[model samples]
Target chain A: MEHLLTEDLLCNQLQHSTKQLYRTGMVAQISLAISKPVSQQFACTLRVGEVGVLLAPSGAGKTSLFNAIAGINQASGFLKIGEHDTEQIELATYKRNIAYVTQTPVLFGHLSVGALLDVVSAQQARPFDIKWALEPLKLDTILHMRTLSLSGGQRQRLALLLAMIKGATLLLLDEVLTGQDPSTKLACITVIKTYLKRNQAAALIACHQLEDALALADIAFLQQQRAGIKQWQVMPISNGIHAYQQSLLNDCADTAQDQQTVCASAFLSVLHATTISHDPQLGLCEYRVAGQPCFSAYSPHISAKQSVLLVLRANRVAISKSLLPESSFVNQWQAKIVSIRPVSCQGEHGMLIDVTLVNQGALTTSQQDVVSVWITRLSYNQLHPKIGESWYLISKADAVSLSCLN
Target chain B: MSETDLQAIILTLQLASLTTVCLLLVCVPCAYFLARSRSVVKPFIETIVTLPLVLPPTVMGYYFLVLFSPNDGLGLWLRNVLGIELVFSFSGIWLVSMIYSLPFTFRPLQSAFEQLPKDLHHAAALLGFSPMKQFHLVILPAIKPALFAATTLSFAHTIGEFGAILMIGGNIPGETQVLSLALFDHVESFNSQAAEQLALLMLIFSFVVVFACQWWQTQSSQNGYVVNNHVEGL
Candidate 1:
């Protein structure tokens, strides 16, 4: 049998009808077939040790799905974890051999950090080397301290480390990086990636940071709601963030009110770029995207030739018929409008115009540097921007958010 | 104090001590079940545990007295098979005390267990601890103060028991007679001095129990032992 976890769980959000009776609040159907050792296929199935990220707005049943998979919550479904058929055998949570790190690290408070580590080491068949993470996660100094005395980030780091060391084939991490600083968050991400690769273990990490989640995930699972039912859909992320964002835009329109964050992310384009120049004195950095220069505020962390992801909000992108005199808009690109379509987002009507860089060669979908601009109904009527027309797009330096690619 | 009064005092201490031990042994499992079990009959079982708290001790003793009568089926079976005699004996009163003080010992433990971090057991299980180990290492240690509270309250409550002991054990010298019965006998015979002395001793003992429980809770809070168990729900 394949080392895989498959579930078609039906979960309900229950509310108390009176003091004793509970009425069904909402129902969600979570069906996923995740394979160990990461398989590469169409978006139909996720090859999971390559790491999958579960993305949804709050209360989309991400944690509920994790609980179901961990055998903590009972849901009616055809559930299987590796050789154990959960539907046939009532497997205990620990018996499932799945490591679950909840939002708050559930730790033994009575035990010291060292004692906790000792217990985990003694119990696990193959313990992950805590020494490898001691320095980076800053857990070395706190090893002798009691777990109850540790800060939020320290607790999260320890929890993740222990879960990895438990040597479970699957890891369910729910917002494990919430309390960490930027450097620590990067360290945790690196540590998680290293552990997964080294152990050939699959992880379904639920995080709200789209860039970080996408950077770490081979494929993304979007918990989408259609009509009254919510479902988990395998979202292909091979074409980078643009294709994924575009897919969200296309599929999440109907549920815009419930998925405000998803809709907000859909209205932005994430471009992969490399830094060309940085002037710390002037606090400005120039990046090359699709063979064009894009300028943004400087950061000490971003050096020349370092790859980065630039987030450009569609509404901030302004297009003109001709090149105009720049005031504070430091970045400008000459492009040809490829498609113009009317769209309603968050109950507001707008026109989404897709533009491609001028003079670019025949590019595949993955290589296409398409910048989407959202113009309101008033601006659409005023500009009368037509498809296949050449235009100049202007954006302020601050409008572009520079995120370092991991 | 007279020799009979001394014998009654000794017997009361022995009864309270033995009854408290038995209550702890029995109530730990009962409190654990009441705290964690989701069975359909949980409410019914909870009601039974609480019955001793609300009903008059004489009423509880009357039921047990009927149950332990030699003419009754259960009492006859015990006498025939085990050669055990419970009525008007030390064992009879000790058993009654355990039942009478059940809620005093069990309620605090149940509340503490209920207030325990919900995921503590789950965390222990995932860490490969057996269920027994989880209880010994995680659950017991977390509720140590409550354990102390339960033991002291049950001991104190058993010491104060009078009506149930009278109904079951009767007033017999050095066998089933206890301090409460001696004090009652002294007051009825117009021996005001001995009765006053026994009443004063009982008052001081009750004060000590309340002070010990309050002090234990304060110490536990100061040491952060109880604070650590109060993890916010996820």
Candidate 2:
């Protein structure tokens, strides 16, 4: 909530600049008749250092929007940088200021990483550090490797570097980085976030990762239907970002007090495994969401190839910096803290730490993986966990339970 | 090889070289248009361009002969006004070879142009690559195998020409008599040894061309590039 207010204040501070050059050098305008006419008309004013996220599935008009903004597709729209619309300006010439890293990266096949960087770097009028760009991507050692030979993640990082070196004012990234390790994802996100903040630039990241959307986005442009027509509505995620997760809200309820649904903190999301294996000796049903924390529950009804949503009590889930080896706990998953707030559990001061599961398959039908891990205020202070810091979510296998979903 | 046969082979190489270079210059843009344009005449244009692949060479030659005969109005106008002649000359064979082997070039180039994902073009545009620059940097390299196949096939096809060049640009010594015509003359004259030697050369050239094309396609595909980033399009 505090972050959202600061964001509003930040926007207001940068709003009244016309004559004096502003921090965010240019203001981008997207007014047009799109291919997906009604669906693509999402608008909001963004300042430098402000990041907006477009949360939608693939094939949901995300790339269409990116194409329209980049002036690649034949759409009737005004793409303006600063006061003059780009359409009125030289629209036919390739506009170097717009950096669009598509999901399927199209790189110059023959050029090595160092050569690509050197070429794009020479085109820039402003100063840019190639080492700084390569630092977060961890691509310094692979400078001689050809762009065509790089992996998907490597291509994404290189695209970002080229964008930075070329000085793109409005960075439009289409889920370029995915399937990275927890630390790597954080590093990539930090690189982008810091670049935007320092340059006084704005970005719109199209992502399916909730943590990415929540952690970096000042505003969430969501897909919704109004009067049977699809449109975009800007939902400010400054305060209570988790409440924006649809499943966390009870459809039957209407109040902010009931915003966190009854089942919100109850279920844990397991993305990959189709079947759950039962350990007879421990009497536990084990399922693994690949690259995410594992879950084990004492149940017999859950069978192989079953998609079951395990029930996790708020108190049973524990957060720690390291694995709790002393306790007989087996179910553990790595997650990063999103937000922490004071709450009263059993008439005691407790911290409701919101931890989001980190992975490419972090998406869920319901806000299941992102649940509250209740810890006493003393433990929270002693551990000193902050937002974006990784921590383990653990529960004793014997204490866990599961309910099968049809 | 005799002096006459040597002259014929030299003329054939010159014609094939000129035709291949000119045809590629025309086909690259035509194939690009065929792959991407949505104009109303696109279907008609595509059919006309690809006709040489399926049409009999003699039938195609017959049409060209009728169209470009100096007696015809359009042919006479080009000759008198532009100082250009297209019938019974080296220039005529060059033009005829270009038309007859067009499909050999256009089909592969067109297929390569079509095989590329549209996203790459957009990425090139955002990266500030001009149309020609985009073609050089992105489109050309990506379609190298097809380009190789198209150029070699067109050259080989023009070299082995018979029916079309014979009909439109009749075998005039030193001007239009190509290798294929010399071989025919050798065989018809019952010079079995000369015909055998010429046939062996043509056979070796065709084999090398085919082998090179196959090697290029395999090399391009196995260039250690893996793109797993699948972005769904709307």
Candidate 3:
């Protein structure tokens, strides 16, 4: 009896292995391109077990790119999944191995959750415990409930679980967590990541939010729309700042000379306003005037006016309880403390104080009305200002830069 | 009951049962293919299947008579190979009924199959079920209501068949003469009382059968299985 059981198990494992090999060989290899009238092109090759995160402005063909890969749209390029080298396979058969979760959850609605799973499992000839599957997705409570009764997030999770239950090697997810809360989104990411890791399944997710993509992406693909669809460029999160700055510089290059020159002058003026020491070891450069800390930057070349906006370093700015004496070294203003948040920077204790700046007497008018600045909690406490108290704020001349805006 | 009347009833039941069985075997696959296939030939096949639904009964009957005549190649082959003539035979009447009721059976099943979520089939494939297994296990079970409705419609339609069956079967007692034909025979023979009695029986039987089928369907649905409610293809 034991020998027979072992033989049966071995046979089942062999059958599974053969089916997987066939499926892997038959999976499509997709390359996508978007061409616009302006001749902007983006393209990328998709591989199994690789997570491709697509980020672009709305209408950037993110959805279209996925559709083309799924063979739901007409696209000009090579789309081969494994050995199947056809523009479109038999639609029904081709779609059988690919699971696509649309932006909106589309369910049969009539079948009970258990019944639906049973039918799906029976058809797939795979052993599945519907109750066990539902439990992880938090859908066990609603197994007997009507599909329409599920909330948006619940429905989204259900759709995801359904796709997972299908056991497809490739999953195409489109804005699956568009309206989910932070906790729900985190939970969903955890579920998806675990599924991908366990099954070696490749997923292509279209996302508009950076945080979500960063949370789950193993490989990040940045998509930009030009004349048409362009190839996705894999970028490292560690180089996020540099990449962002370079892209801004490229954008600035397209502006008229007058505008660029003006932006450059503004940046220069801010940089030259003051000078302060920055710690090179900490990647912290500070600009201050008359011993009053103002603005800081990660790089040594802290200039006020670059044709781009520089990131404001959190450490250099100091806060005080009362309005300090008027000084030439730093920009000063009265701001009401909104919130006090604790933070850690490079093994140093810090606090982030959200302050609403009161621009009382500045005369320069601009298209945008107000500007807000973030200060550390230590600075806010040093100022000894209460939550609603308005306190004086200031920045060194060099730290106050208009140079990078160009 | 008279011998003729009793024979007609038995013949009617047999023809309807046979037609329903044949229709299911042929139509299940045909309907599933029609529902799922995206081939270029789909529209052409659909038009052919639907021709009987719109073609006048008399026109269809004329074609059947011509097609089944012994002089025709197909008819001669059937006669020689099967030792049976289709014209003016009970088998001829069953064939006509199957053709006439094809739309009634196929449309419900087709729509039912179509209404099933394509994702379910995709899931099945990923789970490693072959095409045949998926159809039998997933597609068949999901479209059970449509199957039931199709069976009921086809059975009822076969039982009430007249023009096409008449053209092909003639009014032979104990062979081709169904209940409907039996009622017509009574009227033609000037047996008014017998004709009235048969008519009343036909009316009551038709009403009861249809109502009972419909009630069963409604009960199944109310108990939570949703029947296919989409418009049937003519």
Q: After aligning candidate 3 to the native by TM-score, how far in Å is the CA of B184 from where it should be?
A: 1.4
Model 2 error, position A240 (Å): 6.0
**Best of the candidates, DockQ:** 1
Clashes of 2: 3
Report per-candidate DockQ: 0.44, 0.27, 0.19
TM-scores vs. true structure, each candidate: 0.77, 0.69, 0.61
Model 2 chain B worst lDDT run, 10 consecutive residues: B225-234
The interface root-mean-square deviations, each candidate in sequence, come to 2.0, 2.9, 4.9
lDDT per residue, candidate 3, B1-234, as tens digits? 788888888899999999999999999998887888999998888788778888887788888889889876889888988887989988788889989999888888887777777665644544445678767865676666777878877887788887788888888898889988888888898988878887887788778766766776676565444465523333
Candidate 3 at A335: error in angstroms?
20
Query: What is the DockQ ranking, best to worst?
Result: 1, 2, 3
* Candidate ordering by lDDT (highest first): 1, 2, 3
Model 1: per-residue lDDT, tens digit, A1-406? 1112223222121112121211121111124332222211111222225567776656667777676667666644333332221231256776665778888877877677888888777766667676788788888888778787788999999998888777765677999888889899889888877776666556777887776775567656764444434555554443334555665566567563535444531465666677888888878889877677788877667877887777777888889887767567777878889988777655657788888766432333344567889887898899999998999888888888775333
lDDT, candidate 2, A94-206, per-residue tens: 55356777777777665789987876665456646647757678889899998878888888888887777756667888885576666777677788887886665678878
Q: Determine which window of 10 residues in candidate 1 chain A has minimal summed lDDT.
A: A19-28
lDDT of 3: 0.60
